[model samples]
Target: MSLLADVDFRRYWLARMVSLTGSLVTYVALPVLIYSVTGSSLWTAFVVVAEGVPYLCFGLFAGALADRLDRRRVMVIADLVNAVVLGSIPAAWAFGVLTAPHVLVVAFLTQILFVFFDAANFGALPALVGRARIAAANSAVHGGGTVLEIIVPGLAGVLITLTAPAPLLLVDAVSFAVSALLVRAIATPLQTGVPGPPGGMLRDIREGVVFLSRHSIVRTQTVIGCLQSMTGGAFMGQFVPWLDQTLGIRPTNDARLGIMYGVWGAGGIVAAVLFPRLSRRLGEPRVTLWFLPLSALAGLACGLATNWVVAAAMLGLWAIVYSMVVLTAITLRQRVTPDRLQSRVNTAGRMISFGVGWPVGALLGGLVSEATDPRTAIIWTAAMTGIGVVFAWLSPLRRLAGEPIPDADETPTPAQREPVPAPDRIEA
Candidate 1:
């Protein structure tokens, strides 16, 4: 069946899209609020630091907990928590008691909640869709959000100026509430069985790590995924300045910048729509092996292009290749992982890929851009992705290329058997 034709998936897709669109508004608004309130670049930098710290600190625990609890219940409670906290920004602003620290605290709190929400969500999607449609389901959810990402950031910028950043976050609060309702409305099971008393949290987390570290394809894809996130973060970090430095499109040129962003988003949209097909035809391993080099080449091309036209096209192509690598790695991890370990294992990997890799890459790219020019920095980061390509060629992933995905039955293994009986498949 077509993914959208499935009633619960349709609701699930809309819930994710709605939450993403709202957050995109906050993404711009929160920074604007901080700057307007504190007027300190250091405080502004704290916002970025605050967002990443929660992911690193709480990511694994959230995942471990999700696996032991009812995932959908966890998601719903998280959304409600997010709604109250996010709504606080506007509430404080209305009473004229808003401060920079208040906004910053809200920023940190919201992100912490996101770590939990996202952990539960990672598990919930696979449970809702089942294994057969995992790739397509992932694409549909990401594709919808990518489309919003293209449209909403620009609109959020405009809305910030018009409605003020503080008032605008209410939209985010409302979105979270709506998301909670939608998630609750789903008629399908979000887990295979009701969770029993979990073992030691540390022990549960260890099991996830040992499994990830031992499984070759899953391990290889995750390591490559970390590398991709790092370099991709580094590459994008220098993107704006590279445009100004190479093609003479200054930061103030919104029309040209908007078009460039739209072009990049279009590339993401194309990749998201096509990745499932690519995975089916080429297999996930081959897709990653083939595309890793293309991403590096495309990144290098963008760095080399002095003309705006060439730069734009290369950036679009780079986005496609780059996004596909990330998506395929995620799909591979989810496909191999048992449902019981889905949240813990996937979140553990993300803690490395996103929590650690992204911030580090941005910091490294910034340092490079400082030492040299943005153009040179872009080239350096592009070259960095070649590390992933080389590793792919040497790793077990290379041999797995062109092989079909294993059946779902083959996925659940004796290696990590739980004492819990076969799941009764009840709604949480």
Candidate 2:
């Protein structure tokens, strides 16, 4: 049965799509606003840091709590909070009080809320669609976002000329408001279980950690996800500066910058359309092994290209393989993880992959860009792709010639179940 026919999944998908459409536009505008004001790659990198730091601090807690509470309520409340906070951006801009520091603060707070929302969201998908349909559902959810990325950013690029990026955030604020409504409208319960008596948040966190650590496939891919995000962070941090410095595309009003980023959306489309086909033929693990090496090469080419058109083209190819690697790895983890552990395991993995990896890469890229040049920094960061390839080859993922993926819905009886690993106590 098609997941589209499922009411809960459809509403969930719509809520997500609406939020992504707005966010993608803001994604382009935020950097443009930061760079136009601060004129420093390091400051731009700070935005990436702000986006990640909250996840580092609250990611575990959010995940633990989400498992215990109503997924729908947590998600809806988070969206409402985000809507209000994001609305403040345009308010500040209207009052002529906007500053880079204000932007950073908002960015930090926004992500903090998202970490909570994200914890619930990570669990919601598998609960709604089941593990068997994950690949197709993911493709649809992300592909719809990609299609918007292609259209909205290019339009946003042109829109930048007509207004300040700060005001554009109002659109994001509205999108969040709409998403909350849609999520609230879903009738089907998004959780399989409410879980029995409280284990306490710390213990709950430990349970998630224990499950992820004991599972070989999940652990290996968590590291791979980090490497991939690092590669992403570095390239993203340097890109604005690279475009501005090399191609004379100013952040204030350059359609070229928007058009360039939109091209990545086109690449994402290629990935979305191609992933299921490739996974069916090549199998999941092998897909990453082969495609990522080419992405590394493409990323390197992005740094070396002299012309804007060539650089954009290289970035598009890089985006395709990069997105594919991420989708494959994420599905593998979700497929292995049981429904109860979904939020905790996924959040921990993302905290490491996105929170830690992205910030570190961006910070390093910023430092490198400050010391040398954006192009040099880009080349250095792009090396993370190659490094990830090495990690994948060394991990157990490489030798699985025909091992079947885990069944997420499978629950062994107590007598049949192997003794699972216990929680490793986290020391303060």
Candidate 3:
């Protein structure tokens, strides 16, 4: 069946698009709200910290909980929690009691909820779509989001100009509520029958860690993913400064900067459109091996481009290659993991790659730019992605370059196995 024809997947796709569009608004609006309230860049910076810290703190635990409980319920509860927490912002504003501290706390709490929401969501898609269609499904979903991303920020910026930022969050709060209802409507059996770890949450987490360690493809890709995130973080961290130094562009030139980034997003949309077909022709392993290195080269070109047109073209290329690498890695991870371990393992990988890698790379990039030239920093940061090529060669993923994906109907062995009756089949 075509993915869009699946009722459950349609609901899931709609939920993601709605939530992401709303999130685009909140992403711009929240900082605006914080800045308006405090007039302090320091407090505005704290919101970024608040948003990140929760992912680091709660990511693994959230993954374990998602695996242990009913994933659907976990997602629903998380959405509702986010709705209430975010809804409180407008409520406080209405009461004339809103403060920077309140917004920061809300930001932190909502991110913690997102950890749970995402951990559940990472696993939920594979269950809904089946392994064979994972690539196409992910592509379609990301493609839709990429298109909206291009438009949503501009719209959000206009909305913020005309209305208060606090009320903008109400839109996000309502999106979460709608997402919850849509998720609750899915009839798929999201929970795996693999027996729970006997010890505790830590044990469950350890099991995920061990699986990630032993699984050659996941380990290689996870490390590569971290490096990719670091490179991306560094490039983006230094982007504005590099543009100013290299092209005489300033933040005031919002149109030019927006176009550059929009071009990058356009590349991502193209990658999403092509991913499934590319996976079919080259196979997942070759796609990974080739795309990682290609993205590094593309990043270098982007850093060195002197003309706006050339820079946009290079940035677009980098985005396309980099996004393809990411999509391939995620599809591979989802395909190989067992149902029970999916959330725990995937979320653990994300915590390592995203939570830790991005901030570190961004900080390092900023330091390099401050110590030297922004162009040098951009080139150095972009070049660091080449390390992924070396890592991929040494790991098991190299074996997959020409390999077909494993049978979709098969289940991988969990780290620990108990002798038990077979579980009932759950339709995708």
Candidate 4:
């Protein structure tokens, strides 16, 4: 059966669609809101940094917890928590109590909760659809999000023009509540691995970290992912200001900006549709290796484009190759990770790529923007992506280019299994 035909997978997809559609609004609105409040590029970037900080602080714990608890329950609770947390934003705005710090705190807390939600989500799909369908399943998820990326930002730009960005967050809050109900209705939990003997949470997290560190392909790809994310975070952190100062686009005159965002997402849609076919032909690792330089070139073009139209086209092209890298990386991680360690290992990898990488990039982008110009900062960000190209050659991903991912039914060799600690030394 096709992955979409699976009842549980369908529910999960819808839940993701609803929540992410709303989030696309907030993603645009948050920066617009911050820029409106502070009028400082640095502060806006700082808020973006705040969004990633929680991932660093709590990622491993959240991932470990998702493995120990019912993944569905973790996702459900996370949605509910996010609803309450995001709802507070508009509530504060209504009372004239909103501040930059308030917004920063909300952004941080929401991401912390998201760490758990995402950890559960990363593991759930493979369990629901099986290893053979990982690429297709992820394509659907990424494709849906990309579609929203195309639609939501244009709508959000219009809405932000008509109304304030603060009120739009309420929509995000409501969407989360709805997503919780949908997630709760999924009959089968995705991460339904047989329960192992109880290990301390720290121990569980350690096992995941060890697995990632020791696996050659996983380790190498993960580092490359971090570099890619750093560039990505920098681009996003500066995109709004770049639009305003470089292209004369603003929340009020947002058509050009919305179009750029939509075009980029459209590129992602193209990537998602083509990824499975490409992987079949070139192998997943080869796709990553080949696309990395293309992605960098796109980034370079994005930084250098003087005309908004040219910038939008470059960004759209960049999105295609960049999304391919991201989707392939996630699929690689999911395909190889043991079922029991799925959430923990996946989340640990993301902690580096997203949690740490994003903040560092954002901070550097902000500094560069403040020190020089937004355009130059963008160029620097693009230049940073080239580092990944160099790393790829040295990484195991180069060696693993044509290897097929092990099938789910295949038993792992003794070395591939996770190591166990002796009982006496084990912590409670």
Evaluate all candidate structures by whole-model CA lDDT and list the values in order: 0.78, 0.84, 0.78, 0.86
Prediction 2 global C-alpha lDDT: 0.84
RMSD of each: 5.2, 3.3, 5.2, 3.2
TM-score of each model, in listed order: 0.85, 0.94, 0.84, 0.95
lDDT of 3 at 357: 67
Question: For candidate 1, lDDT tens digit of each residue in 170-211?
Answer: 999999999999999889888776764777999888877766
Weakest lDDT window of 10 consecutive positions for candidate 2: 412-421
Candidate 4 wrongly placed segments (more than 4 Å): 195-199, 408-428
Q: Per-residue lDDT of 42-122 in model 4, one digit per residue for the tens?
A: 988988899888888888998888888888888999999999999999999999999999999899999988999999888
Q: Hey, what RMSD does candidate 4 come out at?
A: 3.2
The residue-by-residue lDDT of candidate 2 on 155-183, one tens digit each, is 88888899888999999999999999999
Cα lDDT, model 1, residue 321: 94
User: How far off is residue 275 in model 3, in Å?
Assistant: 0.7
Cα-based lDDT at residue 255, candidate 2: 73
lDDT of 3 by residue, 1-428 (tens): 38889888999999889888778778767866876676543454456556666767888898888888778898999999899999999999999999989998998899889989999998888888877788899998989988876777566666665678898899899999999999999997766464355459997888787777766677778899889887876776566567667876543324465566567678889999999999999988888888888999999888888887888889889989999999998998888788888898899888878776665666667677777866777788889898988898766666556555563346433321223333522211
